[model samples]
Target chain A: MTAAQPATGHDHVVVAADVNGVSVTEPVPTRWTLAQFLRDRLGLTGTKVSCELQVCGACSVLVDGAPVSACTYLAADIDGRRVQTVEGLAARDQLHPLQRSFVEHFALQCGFCTPGFLMMAKALLDRNPDPTEDEVKEYLDGNICRCTGYEPIVAAVLDAAKRMRGQA
Target chain B: MVLPPFALHRPTTTAQALSLLAEDSVPYSGGTELLLAMRMGLIRPTALVDLKRIPEMQEIRTDRSRLLIGAGVSHDRLATDPLVEQHARLLAAAEREVGNARVRAQGSIGGNICFGEPRSDVATVLIALEAELGLANSAGERSVPAEEFFLGPYWTARDATELLTAISIPLPCAEGVYLKFQTVERPTVAVAAVRRPGGDYRVVVGAVGEVPVWADYPGVGEVDPVDLVGRTSPVSDLTGSERYKRHVTEVYIRRAAELLAESER
Candidate 1:
């Protein structure tokens, strides 16, 4: 409820980390989350953050290729680790397979949950390139999409997996 | 959103980590539990000590008869670790069942144990297997039985300066089986059963009590897990009434007992 603290260039020691293939070493506040560090400090606003309350799965990101809720993960924890956000998933202008599939299958109505879903699916497919429909559902058990019903999102993830595995 | 500003220290060695701990220095393991508490104003640490960089504290080794799980091992690693799969499959399964995928990836088994949550699935499984906890401090290292580790909700026997180093489980003589029922973030009730080749069994119930209840069954025929539920007074909070939790606890005990019997066959 108090005023938000100044995010970047704080009076703290720089912790080096790799964010989307970019090695960044900056003085981050000790209390900042990976989501806040990316969106507020690094100017990578593609990583959506929905504050600390609610397990809505809106602030999900990839830390070392693992799907983690960025609302809770400390930025200090990601020091010296690789973080792949929705921004990193795409190479330049070419969309990642999951991003493309989301658009094709109408996975998002408002697109707020798109970034989180894409990053989580990317992590899931990275570990399991060929996940079953049930496996995809299970892998995304934590991720919630209220805008577009789960079936379309699940279908999009399955389609993305197929494309990533070279089957489509 | 703003959190109270604090200094961060990354200690690569156990001795350095121990030296940094004080009344105000909070040692950060996985940050899954601590960060949430900090956000809620439950705890305010002046210094946050990061301990994951220590190599010795991150080793998961197994001997011929027992497996040692480093405190820093993530729940994801525990779910798929070869030694945990072969020696403590019940633990691996419990770890896999603890939370959703993202929580498992970020939370550490040590943080889970040290947090001492009343409805902890990991605590119940560990107590049932009779795992030993390794604690380290500036003084020295000592092993404590899991059954005695948990004192209450969010309370453990660990000293402020001591850090949980590892958890060790012996090879089960029979089978280690655990069953849980949950409709919320925390389980409704969790029961674990360990059997021996000689027919003796160890049963521990979690989430429905102050700590994991290590039960002593009076032989195989005299005491049934279902009947034992009505006899104890378990605290009832958000999950349900005391009576309802007791009912669910009985169900899991019966199912875990059934799995233990099937393991023998």
Candidate 2:
């Protein structure tokens, strides 16, 4: 499954994106962005679309194990790339530690920006298990949260780190 | 919103990608820049050849002599990779400053370099690092040094049928720093400055011109502002005027010199 045969014809592009752990291949318009493809073609709405421009970070999703905004990224460009949205953060009935911490710490108000924040925080903590306040702040700088300010989100991330380390 | 209708092709190999591109198909990677341009209707290609699946273009390997970064390696990976930090820490720092977490995840180094936008932070760092870009076409493979890579704004030496394979960066002497000044907080202005041992310096300024400008100033004897500014062509964009950019470059150069001097001391 590493190399997919190039299908004949160019009318529809075959997208072999591994969303979370699920390998999905679908025919998408050549112009469809990954965000639109996820929301419309694959019916994965967990990856939201807010700022189509690369700014707001509301459309954040993990592409190939790294957080990226899906709005401006084309589905045709992500062939064979692994993508993970907010929907893939949980396992069965148990939410990821970051997700649980967000709820426990009340990190979300309207929750419009929660997914982006969660993804960004997950990216940060995954790379640096014990991130200092400055590191966390620097890492989360791109993810804009208009609600609940930033203290609760930072607290949620810290708490999640503690729980992950068996400290909480 | 949805993308306009167009043809798509996924090329598994670089040769196939080049062939498709030779047939006038637009090669796409990561699509952070291409998609935006498509949305803006700046480019309207009938077919898009996706290069993500090409195995040769996704590797990041470093030897004792040089680091070969695949064109498709994402900014996020570059920013966090231990190897990248060890070899090109300044580049890693600049990678961290690219966009948001999302942009870094989706944006590829090849795409960034080929996009030819003068405001690119990575381009500045690559120029300062004296990176060499590897390009492959149906004909053969050729390497272009970073100093000679960019032709103009949003343009490179790459032909329509050529695919950028890799970028090779020589290992520095464990002494380098990249400092950037952004207009507000979104897009950065001046990008990176690398300081090597023995007072060797490379200063790069981005976003202030049509293409990133590199100046190698080793010591105080070679610090000529007139000669340095004359070599670079700065453009007036929404971010800053040409004069303003030049002024900032001077300020950044002086600041970088001081930082490098302190590091030496």
Candidate 3:
């Protein structure tokens, strides 16, 4: 479901990348953002787009294990890199530990910012398996959550960190 | 917003990149700033010469007493790199907090300087460290002191046909502290105060003004916060009023000096 028919023309560059363990090669418009490529072309709506600037982390995704604002990131730039979106977090019907913690902790009310929060938290945990509360806060500073007041979300990440570290 | 349609060129060498540079063609690295500017309609280059593939621009090394940092190195890499940590620790500390994790991961130090944003933490630190910027064109290469490289807000000394290649910091470099007062995404005022190996001190205050303002002191005791504040004409914007920024700049300069003095003790 990743690779597409090779498009040949100006203003288009073919991008071959790994999306959620699936290899995708598609000809994307040079100006198309990574969020557009994921949501529009690939039908991966788990990644949202807001603010359109890098200010908001609504479209946060990991490129080679580093979080980037997909809204400002060019789709062509994802070529030859491994991209992980929120849609890639689960296995079969089992939710990721961070996902479980979010739900259990009432981390989402509007749910608009969940996917971004999950993805950003995942990036942080992947880098630092055991982040202090302040470290988690600092790492997730770019993201905005209007509904949850951010307290529960921070608690969920801490709880998830312990769960992942086998301390829960 | 979609970027205006433009041809993308991936050049593997500086020569190839230089040949493609023109008034209409721009050197692009992380696209952290350039793409944003393009999408905002502030700039619309007909083509982008991607500099990531140029291997020469990705290196960080030392030549004699100077630390040579390739322009393409990411802020995150610079923050964690042992060489940067050992040589330019102040730059490393500032880079660690520039924007956020995503920005550090994607934005390049060279791109930060080349963009010449008034609120740039990198520019403030480099100016205090007395770093030199390397620029290249089809003709030749030249180095500009970091202080003179930035002309004004979003303006630099780099020509349309030139590309920033590397940053050179003369070693036994100034060691010190960088303090900033930020109420928003960018800093309201950034101050870098450092004592050079020769025992002279420098204080650079940025973010509040169109360009960074600096003053040299033979000794830390001679550093005047009032005189340093007088050198800047801070723009009154959402961050603060001109008078407010001047006050903050003076305070941060004094604080940075105090911290540097304490650390040196």
Candidate 4:
């Protein structure tokens, strides 16, 4: 098969991501990252992209319901896979417990890193609801929060876990 | 920034990928390392042949005596694999410590080994385990031991026409442990040591040299620190001075000895 030239037109790469309980297939660019496809192609820009490199975690999205760096993953790789971005986290008029806890605990100083932190925290708590302080730190080590110290962020995650489990 | 303009080729067979590579097109697996290199202008290829679609290149099965790991298996998969965890615990642990969860999920073992990055944590572990690399081309298939696969800093013994298909790690008679000493938030200096039954050992030190260095331990006698030190000529990079790396290598060797001693007990 002869290789073709790079074109700007949109080619159909089947992406079976669940966007807020809706399974959709879209035609995306061959080189489009999951972050770009979410924001530019699907117009779901709630998942922010700060450092395109995987360092800053600002573009964290749930691939198969696990928090992953969307900026680094190619959209084509997740073909026929389910993806859930921040926009898909909450129900229609009902906020997820982590979202509510972030607002209640003032976990955001600038709100730029909130989505990433929330996604990471959500994934952590989903897997381990009653995580220790050290476990929480280790699990969220990949996330970088430049706005506020991690004290409130950690507290909010813990508090959210308690709230979700009806503990306190 | 957008990825530079390049044609993408999804090759369904290893032969197809090797043919493209023979024509100077780059074969891509994870795209984590190659993408970074392309962005830095270190590698400027006009085409990228994606190898993820190849069925034979994604198998992680085991033979009678060896564990055959496909090149496309991600670090995340390796870390959580039952067979890999049972046979190569140190490798599974090191894979967990690779970059982060994201990189672990996206990066492949083949890409990690084939890239031949000097500072790679998995490369050192593979060398310590005495893994065999399987390479294929239009000519035929060849298996190169991991120790000889890495030639120098970011250099491998791979020919232009070859595509690394799988990595085979021989089941060892010992419990292995990998110890890495990294300065705070960077790559590690020394990586793994395989301590077998009857007190035989193979200590692998990476990031301190151009390629991972393997030293044989005769027996569990009084280990001379000097013997382990200065074995590898480390460079003074931004990570640390050559002197500091040598010192850390000794420290990790002692640490490995203690761990092995406890495991034996």
Estimate TM-scores for all models.
0.92, 0.86, 0.97, 0.90
Q: Which one is best on lDDT?
A: 3
TM-score of chain A of each: 0.88, 0.91, 0.92, 0.88
Select the stronger candidate by lDDT from 3 and 4.
3
**Leading candidate by TM-score:** 3
lDDT of 2 by residue, A1-168 (tens): 443645534666677878889988787766677888888878888777786777777788876667777788777656777888899999989999999999988888989888888888888887788888888887788777877469988989988988887843
- What CAPRI grade goes to candidate 4? acceptable
Where in model 4 is the C-alpha error above 4 Å?
Answer: A1-17, A165-168, B183-186, B197-199
lDDT (tens digit, per residue) of candidate 1 on B46-133: 8887777788777888877778888988899999988778878888888887777888888889999998888888998888787899
* Model 3, runs deviating above 4 Å: A1-10
- Give per-residue CA lDDT, model 2, range B1-265, as digits (tens): 6566677766778877887885346777778788888777888787778777788888888877788999988887898899888888888888978876667777889998998977788887888787899999988999999888888888899988888999998875325667767744435456466665455766666766677776677563465555666667777777678788778777766676567667667
TM-score of chain B of each: 0.93, 0.91, 0.98, 0.94
DockQ of 3: 0.52
DockQ each? 0.40, 0.56, 0.52, 0.31
Which digits, one per residue and each the tens of the lDDT, describe model 3 over residues B1-265?
A: 6778988877779998899899988988888999999999999998888888788899999999999999999999998999999999999999988998888888898899999999999999999999999998989999899999989999999999999999999998899999999977799999999999888999999899999989999988788999989999899998888998888888998898888888877
Which is the leading candidate under DockQ? 2
Model 4 DockQ (Cα-based): 0.31
- Arrange candidates, best TM-score first: 3, 1, 4, 2
Clashing pairs in 4: none
Off by over 4 Å in 2: A3-8, A13-26, A76-83, A90-96, B62-65, B171-175, B183-187, B195-199, B218-244
Clashing pairs in 2: A68-B102, A69-B102
A87: Cα error in model 2, Å: 3.3
